[model samples]
Target: MKRLLVLSLSLLALCAAAALASAPASLLTPDLALERLQRGNERFVSGKMIHPNQDAFRRTTTAKEGQKPFATILGCADSRVPLEVVFDTGVGDLFVVRVAGNVTYFDQAGTIEYGAEHLGANLLVVLGHTRCGAVTAVVKGDHVEGNIPALVANIVPPVEKVKSENPGMDAAALTNKAIEANTWQSIEDLYKQSPIMREMVKAGKVKVVGAIYDVDSGKVNWLGEHPKQQELLALTGGAK
Candidate 1:
């Protein structure tokens, strides 16, 4: 009986150690999580995909257990901008939210909050891209003349604000500016509008970031590290 007890205790200790080792380092700092993402993106842009999801057997095993995606991406419904390919992330690595123009309504905000507060996601990324048709429509004041008007209406306010602030800015510039503004607005909405996300941010449990993907170059410009509010404002117009 004494030998059996010793063996059981030893087995339990080994299991605990293995669990601690397997737990990701991002659980401690959001910066570490960001670093991981940057590295993955770099690999993607360099034509060196890590192919983290290729192991079907391992994926099935993990599926049977559970998932713990590290980051959540709120992005546009554009077919050209695929979240996983651009970021070089695998199936279980990211929780993604997609909508036309990347607009966040009450339900979308709740979904993002759940990813962070309940799904154990440590970071949130609002990703926008250039040459966006939705933004173009809003800039040109071209509502689709149907139920799509509501969607266009949601994207118009930020472009209008940008034009009002910089009266001399042209249509193309305004649309480009609004695409970023809309992205930052989504970032703000994720934090200011969602109670659960706000609490997580306040407690340092999660970090909210903004980014823009240049469709021409396939490069991801991280907005979180922008040095000044003016620069960020110039970039996204949600600088304050």
Candidate 2:
């Protein structure tokens, strides 16, 4: 019993030292961080991911030291779309904030800013997905009449705007458009509504971007450039 306890303590101490030594020297730059995520997604799409951190040792090491996630992803609450798996990231690679419609309310925005400002994360991604139930609910004109309504309410304006723009579009097309619009709107909200995020953006400390994940292809289509504020407002109609 004494020998087993001594060996366990010794192993734990060695693991702690190894984890510290393996910590990244500095936070990845925004562009580099984006590239890493893209590469990981590509691996995911190809079904060729190495899945480096699945070992018990890796999990134990991660628990011992704090995470140093490179990117913060505000993704949907949809079960089909998980940020870590889509990005091929291990336990500590992403700081994720999930909600229906991927909307950025005050609390969500504050959480994202906290990750960037304090966690040394350099990239913020608003990730939406195809066939998102939240977007579909808004497009189908479904309402919950209570607190759930508040959640659906955030998604309605964009769905309505897209409906107005493309009168002849089918339900599938409308849902896709609304999904993209919602993602872009969330990105805009983060930039304009949060002072901390704005300062981080202006100083190049963090980059806020939007992407839509394809459920079928497992690919992420990153919105290359941010749209103008007027264009975004027109799409969302300044939905509160």
Candidate 3:
């Protein structure tokens, strides 16, 4: 047992070393990373995707040198919202953390922090999509079973807030508005849960942004940073 433990520790250390050594000295600033994603989505929308970085050479380089992704995406686990395809990003180009509703619960928050802090991804995007079943389920107050309730619980607050603020709105509009609201809520939750992310954003080490992906149109509508970002940052005295 002792020998096995030593072997495992040695392997882990070597992996971490490789990752650190492969990381670029300079990473893309948030604005540039965002622009790249926008351009890729435009190509996807135009049916002209160049599919950058998917070649065998690219694969071998990333596998040997570890990932150097420029952007970290928190997106829904919906089948229609395959983030890499939607953004036209290829291997080693994006660090993606996906969950239903794209909520920033504890595990997802920690994963995102790893992407930004350890992987050197300077851009963090909370991407919600149109016709999101997670948001729709919460808006309709669907009774989910098993572990699903736990997953949907993170979405409840934003869905309820949208409902309260837009009284008498039809179900379709409520769900639509809630989807966007949920994206912002995920950012708020990220800042609330992870001091690392909050400090990173405060120091301009990373930029947190939101967007809504239209599944039907294959276009990403950028919403930029949260409108109440300063207010959210104030939670940790990160507001300037």
Best prediction by lDDT = 3
RMSD in Å for all candidates: 10.7, 9.7, 13.5
Give the per-residue lDDT of model 1 (tens digit) for 1-240.
Answer: 999999999788656533432345346357766766776677678786555653786489568966677888888889988888887666677889998788777767888878887778888888888998888888887748776777656677778888898898877788788998888777655544566666666677888888988888788889892233233233322113
Q: What's each prediction's clash count? A: 0, 0, 0
Instruction: Please say which candidate is ahead in TM-score: 2 or 3.
Output: 3
Report the Cα lDDT for residue 147, model 2.
74
Give one digit per residue, the lDDT tens place, for model 3 in 1-240. 999999999788656433432334354568877877887788789896667777898899889999888889999999998888998778888899989889988889889989999989999999999999989988988888999998888788888889889999998999999999999999988888888887889899999999999998998999999898887777753212
lDDT tens readout by residue for model 2, 43-101? 78988665645578768877998777888999999898888888777777789999988
TM-score ranking of the models? 3, 2, 1
Would you list the rank order by lDDT, best first?
A: 3, 2, 1
Off by over 4 Å in 1: 1-28, 225-240
Best by TM-score: 3
Note the Cα lDDT for every prediction shown: 0.74, 0.79, 0.85
In candidate 3, the residue pairs with backbone N, CA or C atoms under 3 Å apart (3 or more residues apart, or in different chains) clash, namely: none
**lDDT, model 1, position 68:** 73
